[model samples]
Target: MRFATYELDGSVHAGVVSDDGLHTLPSGTTVLDLVRAGLPAALTAGSAALTGPPTPLDLARLLPPLTPPTIRDFVAFEEHVEGVVASVSGGSGVPAEWYEAPTFYFTNPYALIGAHDDVPVPPGSRLLDFELEVAAVVGRDGSSLTPAQASDAIFGYTVFNDWSARDLQRREMKVGLGPAKGKDSATTLGPWLVTADELAPFHDEDGFLALDMRVSVNGVEVGHDLLSNMGWPFAELVSYASRGTWVRAGDVLGSGTCGNGGCLAELWGRRGEQDPPALRPGDVVEMTVEGIGTIRNRVVPGIELPPVRAARSRTRAR
Candidate 1:
C-alpha cells in the first residue's frame, strides 16, 4: 500500500493512497506513527479502519511522507564512485576500502523538503547538482542486525534527491571533513511511500530491488539506471548502518547516486566537458523510481551571507 502525508483544507493529514482517493487516517496520526506501529499492524489497520470519506487525491498538496529521525546516505554504487573520483581528482578507481564495506555519511534530516517544493541554490554556490537516488524508511528499531534482518525491518521506499552544491562540496572536502554546508541545504523525499510488500515483484534473488530509475531536468532526460546496479544492496547498507549502532523507526537510508550521469559531475568526468549546464534558478528536476513515484522540484535563488573570516597567524614564544 502507498502512504502519504498531505495538506487539505489548511490541515495536514496522513493517509493511505487508493485508486479512488486518499483514505485519511485518524486525526494527528502521521506516516511516521504508522511506520512505528510496524508494517503488519499498519496493513491490518488499513483504510478500512477510517471513518471519514476519502479525500480527493488531486485536491491535497503532498508533503514529505515523514520527517525522518535521521538520514544516512550511502555511496553504494561502484560506477558512481569511479566517475566522481575521476571528476574531482582525475582518479580512475574506487577507493580500496570502499570495496570492504558499504560507506555512508549523515545528512541533516531537518533540511528535507516535499517532492514538489522549490529548492534554493545554496548561498555562494554557482554549480548546483541533483543526485537521483532511492531511500528506504526503517519500520522498526534494530542494532547489530544481519543483512536479512535489516531487509525485514524496512517499512517502505521513496524517491530521494540529494541536492548538492558541487563547488561548496569540493572546497569543504579539501579540509578532509565534509560535504556539510554543501549538502545540508536541501534533500527531497516523496510523492508517497510504497510499502516493502508492494515491491515484492521487483526483488531479485539476492533481495536487491531491480527497479528502473531515471532523472530528468526541465523536460530532457539526463540519467538512467537500475537500482540493482549498486555495489551493495539496500539490505547491506542498512545492516552496515546498524553496525554497533542503531537504526530506528523513521530513520531513512538512501541508495546514494546512481551511475551513468546520475549527477553532472559524473557526466562531466565521462565526457571531459562541463556541458549540459549546471542547475540554475527556475530549472526543474524530476526523479522517478519504478514502483515508488516521481518527485519534481524547481530551483530558486538563495539568501547569501558574508564569507567567514580567515584565521589569524599564531605568534611563536621565545
Candidate 2:
C-alpha cells in the first residue's frame, strides 16, 4: 500500500493512500511511527482501524514520507558516473574502485522538502540540476547483515530528487572531500511511499527493481532511465551501508541516479550546453518512477548570504 504524511488543519498525520484519498492511520501519529511499529504490517493493521471520511489528496498538503533519522545516498550506477566524469575537464572514465563496492555519502536530514514544495535556486549555482532516483526506507534496525538479510530490513520505496548545485559541488570536490554545502542545501523525497510488498512484482531476476525513472524540467524531458540499470542492487547497498555500522529504522538509502541520462550533468557531457539548459528560478521539475508516482516542484530564488572568502592558514609562516 502507498503511505504518506500529510497536513490537515496544521497538523501532520500518517495515512494510507486509497482510490478516494488519504485514510488516516489510527495506529500511528506519523509515518515514522508506522515504520517503527513494523512497516507494512503495522500500516495494514492501522489502516484497518481508520474511520471517518478520507481526505482527497488534492485538498491536503503532502509532506515528505517522514523526516528520516539519517540519509545515505549512494553512487550505484556506472554509466551515470562515467558521463558525469567525462563532462569535466581533465576527467576520464569511472574510477576502478567504484566497481568494488557501493559508496555513499551522508546528506543533511534537516534540508528535506516534500513534493510540490518550492526549491530554492541555490545562489551562485548556474549549473543547478536534479537527479532522479529511488530510495528505500529502512524498516528495522540491523548491523553487518548480508545482502539477503538486508533485503528484509527494507520498509518501502519513494521517488528521490537529489537537487544539486553543480558549481559548488565542483569547487568542493576539487578539495578531495565529499559534497557539503553543494548538496546539504536541499533534497526532495515524496509524493508517497510505496511499501515493499506492493513493489515485489517489479523485481527482476537479479533482484533489482525494473522500474522506469524519468525527469522533466518546465515540462521538457531532461532525463529518463530504468532503475534496473544500477550496477549494485538496493539490498547490496543496504548491506554495504551496514558494514561496521548500524542501519536503524527511519534511515533512508537512495539508489543513486539511474543510468540512461538520469541527471543533467550526464546530458551536458552528451549534448553540450544549449539544447536543454540548466535549471533556473521558476522552472518546475517533475520526477516520476513507474510505481512511485510523481513529485513536482517549482524552483524559487535562494536566500542570499555573506560572500565566502578563503580562510587564512595559521600553521604556515606568513
Candidate 3:
C-alpha cells in the first residue's frame, strides 16, 4: 500500500493510494493506524472511502507527508562521495570517520516540493544539480535499534531529489557545519510513500528487484544507475541513524545519491566557471528510479529575492 499527504479544498490530508483511487485517511494521521489495525482493517477503511466518488487528485500531488518534522538525510553511498570528491577542486573527502556511521543533515521543512511541483532556481545557485536517492519513511518510533531490528521499523519508500546549490554548499560545508544553503534551500521528495512490503523485493539481491534509475534534462539522458548499486543497505542505515536519535513515524531518511553518474557533478566530471550545468528557465529535469515511478520538474528563474541579510545569515549557519 502507498500513502500520500495531499491538498484538497485548501487543507492537507493523508490518504492511501489504491488502484481504485486514493482513499482518504485522517488528517495528521499515519499508516501506523492502518498497520496496527492490521492490513485488513486498513484496506477495508481505505477501500470503503472509494465508494463516494472521491475527489480525483493528481497522484503526483504534494502535501507535507509529516505536517512538519525533523528530516534527516543520510550520506550512505561511497560511490557518490568518491564522485563528488573527484569532481571538486580538491575532491570531497574528510577523515575516515565521515563514513563510520550513517551521516545526515537537517533540511528546512518548508523547502519540500511535492512530486509534481516546480523547483524554483535558487538564488545565486548557478550550479544547481539533482541527486537521485530513495528515502525511508519511518513507521515505528525508536531511539536506537540494531540493523536487523531497524528493518522492521520502516513504513515505506519514496524517490527523493536532494537538490544542491554547489557553489554555496562548497563554501559552507568546508567550515564543518552540516550542509546549509547548499542543501537547505530546496529538497524535492515524494510522488507517494510506498509501504515497506511493496518495497521489500528491492532488499533481497536473490530476488534483486530491478530498480533502474535515470535522470534527464531537456529530454537528454545525463545520469543513470541501478538501485542495486547502493553501498550500504537501508536496514543498516536506519539502525545507525536511530541509534543516537529519535526517529518517529513519518520522519524521512534518505539513501544519499546512488552511483554511476548520479549527479551532474559526477556526470560531467570536474566543472569550471566556463562549463556549469546550472538549471535555467524553461529547462526541464526528470528522474525515475525503477520501481519508484518518475518525478519531472521544470526550472524557472526566481523573480523576487529574499532579504539579502537574512539569506546570507541562514546560509552561514547551514
- Model 3 poorest ten-residue lDDT run: 267-276
Which pairs clash in the backbone of model 2? none
| Tens-digit lDDT track of model 1 for 58-166 | 7988899998899999998888888888776567888999899888899999898998999988888998999999999999999999999999999999999999898
Q: Whole-model Cα lDDT per candidate?
A: 0.89, 0.86, 0.70
User: How many residue pairs clash (N, CA or C atoms closer than 3 angstroms) in each of the candidate models, in the order given?
Assistant: 0, 0, 3
lDDT for predicted candidate 3 compared with the true structure: 0.70
RMSD per candidate (Å) reads 1.5, 1.7, 4.7
- TM-score for all predictions? 0.96, 0.95, 0.83
User: Which candidate achieves the best TM-score against the true structure?
Assistant: 1
lDDT of 3 by residue, 198-282 (tens): 7676666543334788888899887777766665677777787787777776678888887776787765443423233667778
Better of 2 and 3 by lDDT: 2
